[model samples]
Target chain A: MSAAERSLRGRAAIVGVAESSLGEVGPGISSLDLIGQATVRALADAGLSKSDVDGLFTHSAFFAQPVLTTAEYLGIRPRFADGTATGGSSFVGHLWHAAAAIEAGLCEVALIVYGSTQRSHGGGLVASGAALTRSWETPYAPRIPASAYALAAARHMREFGTTREQLAEVAVAARQWAKLNPAAFVQDDMTVDDVLSSRMVSSPLTVRDCCLVTDGGGAVIVTSAERARNLPRPPAYILGAGEATWHMNISQMPDLTTTAAQESGRRAYEIAGFGPQDIDVVELYDAFTINPILFLEDLGFCAKGEGGAFVSDGAIAPGGSLPVNTNGGGLSYCHPGMYGILLVIEAVRQLRGEAGDRQVARHSLALAHGNGGTLSSQVTAILGDESTL
Target chain B: MTDNVRADVESLSPETAPGTVFDRYAAEGVLAYQSCGDCRQAVFPPRVLCPSCGSDDLGWEPSAGRGTVYSATVIAPRGKEPYTVALIDLDEGFRMMSIVTAGDDGAVAIDDPVTVSFRLAGDEPPLPVFAVEADR
Candidate 1:
């Protein structure tokens, strides 16, 4: 079954989406606490209780565990449980799997959840000295994520004449959107000077270009289109979803500047029987400033080697030709470790016109894309109006 | 103080380090990569097996430490000095990221010749540094 022929379009809809307190909640809160809160909230939004859910999916890397942990915490006994861990893309992949499970009659409803103590507890993205591979990267000490990313940035600059200012522009645009989002972390008035003056975490990448570590959780409830008609909000129909991995090591990649999102996004569009032009808005996962630039190209928004410039001229800003990452993004919004889940939540909100100040007018279709690993793995999902169902 | 001496002096020691692949290279001075017999492909970041072939039949191979800069970035500090970092496309086909030295003549161009060196920082192993490969 090639993705282009999948008929899952509009078979399922996202009825509910919720999030626990983003940023630092408190010292006493556990990762599980955030997960439980978001799940309960999502179920309540769907007007369903624990007893109504028969399926569940969560990131294996995240401790959604004890099986009984989330089920007991939410007071439900689900017949289906999925702990698919493909890094950051876990949530988007779960949506597809949940849809299949429901369509296959394995369960009536599925809850996909994610949570992390990345900020309050810290040590989330920090390099561990114990990993055996550290020995190789430790000598030159170029193994830190920023330095590693610089290697790719250097390649992009050499290959396409991408400039530091071009990369800085992405940070500036994200900050502009962040200023509009009440939930964003680094909402201070940021300028190109602020980005250039920022301490270098890696060459071509500044600490300012990086995302904030946060403690947060987001969850969504999925069910048949028939059930979605009765939910609190209009359902955001699942048009299509797809995921893939290119390479694990940054050095082994055929091209550091390009991402697997190209293939993932292509497959997703084909599955939904839509094209890139059909997308009215986007919620691209931007863990780092360069991520979305690479994503913009991979998703076919512009030709390759034009990512750095395509973002220029305020094309992605609120009033630009294409409004992206409206709820601030992983770059500006709270990035709680595996932030891919939040993209789905945000996309659904925008499509439903629920985003107060960040909403894009008449958002008929939205693309939610997530990058895992060091831009090694990718997941792209296309969502549309429930009337399409 | 002088370009020659600074190029000789190593940076980044093991004492102030993390568990990274470079730490081993710094301490051993061996440019090692993951080689899969199954796929005849050599990889970096020291994977357990070949991601291409999914075979655990993999071994660490020492590189000759020879390559060319696939790309480079020369940074002019906002209020500080300038430095360069590069992606060296190794002879083994894998790429190694390191600070480019040996030339203060502006930026290193793509395909520029480079060889591996080490920088000693604190108690940590000497960090991997690259110098222009005159022969290339």
Candidate 2:
């Protein structure tokens, strides 16, 4: 094998990852309070206290809203705080930002947190929220994200031979994974027939194709390789990361069948110096079942139009060659509005050898990718074994 | 409202208060987009300021609303089923997502010819939609 054969395997590490309960924790808990609990748990998991955290990154629907005043309530003043709101994609973007900050020695440890009360707060569609309301989108029928995403799903069916069954396969696999996850919401070992028979939300995408609505919070702590040696568990090193945007609104996107994930995935692979073949596991944001089908092709796991087939034959299952969404995923796991953060936490646990039953075989490299705002944005993060660093 | 922005049935209006451009176009029966002077970019759902260059200098230019069907889906959810959403590429070089009023005849191909129309979603202002243009 030539020197070009392999790329740099490991670099940064995730020392701690935590989340509040997957189910509704009650309306008594505000989004900020959930953030506080998740953040504290993450710090404890890393064998550190809130005082040890100097960096904070958050993707909030309530960014400037009064509920985001967590720094004061937690009593920890982080020197770095990023409130980047790229829809659900913000979590993956935050992971990349934290990795860069730690690598630059700007912060010793970074805590990226996300919290939402979807059940009680009535988490509005990502597009209807304050974040996505630009001049053009608001005027056009409120740019319902479900309707917009429905539009994209329709296009995919028109262009390629992607079928409703293929879309159902994604939901089926997710629900199967959910069965193993004690925290999952819907776990009936669904079949394609069950998915097809389910009620429709926007067309093409049935209710089952869409993610769950739960009130919860998730957080993860990232640190440099040197700082991780003292942690309670081995860290999941940051191997590569990348992010990109296609268009502000669904209507303006150049191509809906494909996502910005192609460019983002390519850039991430280049930075990590690894290709798709080297990845042992994947955690893609499945806000809609169609998302995984589109992303698998864009991420270069399979050829275009083959996503329908790629999802079939149990290829993405736990024992499959590529185990995706091992923690039940947004489709099964808790999708408290921003489901991307949960993907990162799950990957960190898998890499740290913490997943007792859902763990894949000797997983050394993993990829976490997410989509934001009707597939308007995308971010990819790669993790590896600590020893590779 | 450009003349082409009118509803296909000659009935519904997409907006409650149609903008000056849309009103004028509705009267004239023409389709057009806003062109920004700063970046020379074409903006759909026309805007006063250029999103690319932030230039306030803008002008209305005629649009063919003729392009290919980039991608489409037929959503059959419980309440809403059997409706199509297509991404249309305009002759002026911009893409937009809208409901396809007609069936997916061969006319809805990748590079099909579509003429712009206004869609009335309930009572809100009519929205810009596209259909297979008839032969001239």
Candidate 3:
């Protein structure tokens, strides 16, 4: 496709990706400290220096103007800048926006970064709830995203015959993946029973079903496809990406069991000229156990009501037919407020065969999906190594 | 953008905006939603412009006070009384988030028919909650 066209597959590539100190960094660490650390390492991994950067994309709870703050911190003036913050999926949306900028020759060496210290600062639960825009539901003290998500989960279960065991399977699989990843927040063995028996925070979802509150930051470096090919690390080519949102409030969503991932995934796949079966590995923003199931169905991996069954029998776990969230995902991995950046980092690692023990055998095309708000913003990206390109 | 940000960016005057007008209706012990004059679409959490039609000519309409529970959940915070929160679809063709005052905790479920119940406490602003009514 032409640069002027909407499609941007293989027009830009992710040259480097890295993460800062994960799990917990203590009270002394700030969100910018992690962002700076990750930026330095990520630029180095891309075989590029600070002077080479011209485009900057970032999202954070720490800055009202994320790009401007990050640019001043890195001491560089970017020709292009964006600070679009739509919650957790903000970073993933950055990837799509970055590629478009590159293809349009707006700038070169785009940096997409994110950082958070919610766990270290404490009040992760309270802060998460407060972050959600409240109104009619505020008086009732619904646990913000968790309670909102539980409402959707309950409806899905009632409509599709999905059981708590099916939901627990997602957490168990994430824990299994966590055991192989040292950077994971929790690496202990977990089972369906364990997840089911864990403390219930919101009905239809237990504490175990929720994502962890941990401190971490991650960054990705993007450049033109030609430049990325000459970088030190194997380029994770941007095959296709798409973003869509239908509602901000959980109650406003048209359907409880469905999400906007359906539209986002379809747009991404159409742009990439490929479907889910072509993807080798999958990385989904699993903020809650029900997230993967909902995304799986909406992303066309399975029929709408079949997500519960598709995830059962170790489907997305390490010894399974399909590899997912090899870096442990938000469920067992570190979730530093916004998790979209980590999703991109994990996909790039898998595509480049840098995932170590958790690496999938056929590491070519990978799909990363990010969810923000109460399943509000959905951004899907399809990335691949040079082979697929 | 988050809805909060959108609300702020497109904020209306206090006499017409979501927060104030809705508060005024609550103070008078009634539930109201915005009805677009152009599209006739029912808008909850009122907006200056009709989200469906981009029409600025919007007016308020009182709800018939009955709805169906589209979804429900119980937030069981530690050492606190669990309460039911639900997404209710009003018969007037709009949906809203509300508290479900059921006979038992976690008793409300999807598809349950409910009616509006007022919680008009002293000093605090009156708000609407749903009562899971027994089948008659």
Candidate 4:
């Protein structure tokens, strides 16, 4: 493909990626403090200084002006800033925006960061039942997040004959991966029966099926491919990026069995000139167990309604056909509200051959997919080694 | 129904644009949805402009009060009685979220037929909850 055709392919790369703290960071630490720490660490990993950053991107429900607040706290005046808030997938969307900005010569170095104290201060991921429109649904006291996702899980089962065991397999697979990750919140073995017997937060979903509510933050530094060569770490070149949103609330989703990942993944694959088979590893957001199953189907990894079978028999487990959520994912790893940033960080690590024990042998081409809201927003990013680029 | 069914409803303020009209219809024990006068399509949550045709001509119409359960989930908070929440696909081509009360057993399931029922929510209007159809 021509450079003008695939504008972002190999044009911009992730030079550095790091996290502030994996699990608990205490209640005393504010979100801004975590952002600052992660920013400093990521820049240092890239062998760059704070003065080299000219663009900033971040999103937070706790902050009114996320980008502005982060820039001010870091003592740097960014020439370009974006505070796009579409739930967890906001940071993945930022990667594409940053690449576009660099392609347009708007900025040379872009820093995307995220931080949250949800576990310590915000009651640990419980749904408050606060509705945006006070629609007819609010009076019934619906448990948010869980209830919202359960609706989709129920529909998927009804339409595809998906079994509860298939959904439980996703959780088990993530825990198995978490065993290798010392920073994971839950690093123990989990069986399908263990997941099934866990306390039911929402029907078809147990407490084990949900992501952890912990205090954590991460940052990714993006710059032009030419500039990335001089950085300390090997760059994970951007091969493709795309984002889309279907609905904000679960009630308004056109279809409960599907998500916007289909559109977003298609656009991303087109830009990369590669298909699902070309991907060697995947780092998909796992706020809920059903999310990865749904993404696998929607992203064209398997036929529609076959997600249940696709994940069965250790398909997504380590050493399986597809190694997904190798860093334990949000299910067993740290999920501080918006987990989109971690997905990209893990992908960059795998592409750079620095994923430690969770590393896959063929980690040249990787896909980092994220889901925001109740499957409302979707973003897909393709990261690859220089050879693939 | 048992006394401990835990189907308590809460009322919301009707000062907002969307709530003013939706609340008025709920108070009358009618399940109403917005219909675009231009494209003759149905819109949920009641908006002034049609989302499909982008026309400002929107009107309200009483729904048939019947739908099938698209999906269902039971919320079981610790130390609290579990309640069922569901997504209902209306016959008129609109989907909504609501509580499904299938008696004390609470046996609502996907694809089950359901009909609208009303329960008074404080001083505000009566809210809609789906009851599993006897035939299902």
In terms of DockQ, which candidate is strongest? 3
Q: Candidate 2: interface RMSD in Å? A: 3.8
List runs of model 2 lying over 4 Å from the truth.
Answer: A1-11, A63-68, A123-143, B1-28, B35-42, B47-58, B65-69, B72-85, B103-113, B119-126, B131-136
Model 2: per-residue lDDT, tens digit, A104-160? 668878888888877776655332255443344444342256667767777787778
Residue range A106-185, candidate 1, lDDT tens digits: 99898898777667775466221235444333344453455556667777887898888888778888888888888887
Ranking by DockQ: 3, 4, 2, 1
Q: Which of the two candidates, 1 or 2, achieves a greater lDDT against the reference?
A: 1
Per-residue lDDT of B1 in model 1: 11
Name the Cα RMSD for model 1.
Answer: 7.3
lDDT of 4 by residue, B76-103 (tens): 7788888889989999888898888784
Tens digits of per-residue lDDT, candidate 2, B8-55, equal 223324442225555466345466677766687987766556668876
- By DockQ, the better pick of 3 and 4 is 3
Error of 2 at A242 (Å): 0.6
Across residues A121-234, which tens digit of lDDT does each residue of candidate 4 receive? Answer: 865662322446455566777767888887888889999999889999999999989888887888877899999999988888998988888888899999999999987899
lDDT against the true structure, each candidate: 0.76, 0.75, 0.86, 0.86
i-RMS, every candidate?
3.7, 3.8, 1.0, 1.1
Q: Residue A276: error of model 3 in Å?
A: 0.6
User: What is the docking quality class of candidate 4?
Assistant: medium
